[model samples]
Target: MGFRLPGTRRASFATKVASSKSCEVPKGYLAVYVGEKMKRFVIPISYLNQSSFQELLSQVEEEYGYDHPMGALTIPCREDVFLNVTSSFNRC
Candidate 1:
């Protein structure tokens, strides 16, 4: 069975981007933009502590350096790859 580390919590990012209203991501979660379409995904803050996720953050730093225009962490990777990584992360 999957278990979460201490203080780790999962948050849902609804995939419905077609809505006129945007959903508010909770305080403990961060919004990341993924793929060519720049789809947004809200994830738990705990993922930042993972080494693999840190690699992605490195890329984000190189690209935007905390100056992300969208006010979200924009990841420069395919959506599938990001999803695959998060899927594995969820199990941890």
Candidate 2:
């Protein structure tokens, strides 16, 4: 059987560019784009404790090899995530 996903969550799954090379956005995550054309994307993380979250961010930076993929990063929801606003580096 084939499984299909919804539109709004397009970025949630892997994508293949015009090159035909398939690329996955990494499981358990979704990227938020910046600017009108959706140029850049940044990861989101929940759980307050600002300090701890920052630490987690540091780790993500190390793994992603880029400090703040975009000019902003957001952690949607406090206890339960919904959507990350990363456009301004804070919740939307």
Candidate 3:
């Protein structure tokens, strides 16, 4: 899966950086930055409806409010924790 945020595009070192081929999220996917390094992850939009995921969203709201420094949804958690939580979705 590809990872990127809207509006604030990071520079790519790849040779083919087309202006038209920007980071556009697929219809049912959402992009979020996680951890202090702000690593980006693209996940299914359906995850938002899950109780476990909603709890994480709550933490994000409490910490960042609407002012996300990354210009996209940011989840304030360790990368491993976020991965563990999201990986569980595969079982459901």
Top candidate (TM-score): 3
Model 2 clash pairs are 73-89
Every model's TM-score: 0.68, 0.23, 0.71
Error of 3 at 76 (Å): 1.8
- Per-residue CA lDDT of model 1 for 6-77, tens digit only, reads 444532133332121466776787677877888777677888898888888887788768876667777878
The segments of candidate 2 whose C-alpha lies over 4 angstroms from its true place after superposition are 1-49, 67-71, 74-92
lDDT scores of the candidates, listed in order: 0.66, 0.35, 0.66
Per-residue lDDT of model 2, residues 1-92, tens digit only: 11113342444432222112233344544444333343323233332334645664565466554545444453222311122322223322
RMSD of 2: 12.7
- What lDDT tens digits, residue by residue, belong to model 3 across residues 14-40? 112222245776677767778898876
Better of 1 and 2 by lDDT: 1
Residue pairs clashing, model 3: none
lDDT for residue 71 in candidate 1, whole number 0-100: 72
